[model samples]
Target: MIKSVWQGKKTFKAQSKFGHDIISDAPTESGGDDNGASPVELMLSGLAGCTGIDVTNIMKERLNDTTKFEITVDDEREDNTSRSVKYVNLIFDIEGEVDLKKLKRAIKLSVDKYCTVAHSLKATIEPKLIYNGNEEEL
Candidate 1:
């Protein structure tokens, strides 16, 4: 579980069950200090982090990595007052010596089987999430 408490104007301190904590604040223009990401950004970050952990663990356990790795996520969503729906467009920048085929499979498996973030989002909106170079559904 997680909890959030009002920290001040447009800001809150959020903590998860394991004691990890972070500040969620609005943009500076919204009277916030801009010290941390907004709540929406945190959701996206959680999606990326969940997928990243899955891929890393899979690669390591399979002895597939021969160098360092990095991942990045890009999204596409528009502001619409008519509905409470949003979608994601994730683009991953995977750099390392891992096999492309295996890596793609790893991503597929992660999105197909292991990613709770994707599952959670899918509960509300249909998210277009891709891994490696393959587009996947949740």
Candidate 2:
């Protein structure tokens, strides 16, 4: 379970049952102190972290260096009052000697089959690849 308490002036402190704390606040322009990540940013970060863990584990054997693996997530949100997320692009950057096919498969497995956060979202998630420096569509 998760519990959140208002921390005054558009800030909130949320604590999970696992004892992890997440500080969320609005932007200064929105009358907040602009400290910590916003709720939407946290959601996007969760998506990235979830897939990152899955992909790293799935490609453990293929990964030459664990430190070189990274995932960047960019999302677009609706402009309406709700400001719901419309779509998200997951960009994977893996450097070193790893089979592209295997890496792609791992990402697919994470986003399409494994990551619970990915499955929970209503937005469309598109995965992209960046091997070394070249960008490739996935």
lDDT of 2 by residue, 29-135 (tens): 98999988999999999999999989889988778644577789999989999898899999998788788898899999999999989998965767678889999
Alpha-carbon deviation at 108 in model 2, angstroms: 0.4
lDDT of each: 0.78, 0.90
| Tens-place lDDT digits, model 1, residues 1-138 | 787889888889989899999899989897998878987788888888998888878877654554555555666666775433366766667655668898888888888899998788768555576689899877
- Candidate 2's C-alpha lDDT? 0.90
Which parts of model 1 have CA positions greater than 4 angstroms off? 61-66, 82-85, 124-138
Candidate 1: 10-residue stretch with minimal lDDT: 62-71
Hey, what RMSD does candidate 2 come out at?
A: 13.7
Off by over 4 Å in 2: 123-138
Best by TM-score: 2
Shift in Å, residue 60, candidate 2? 1.9
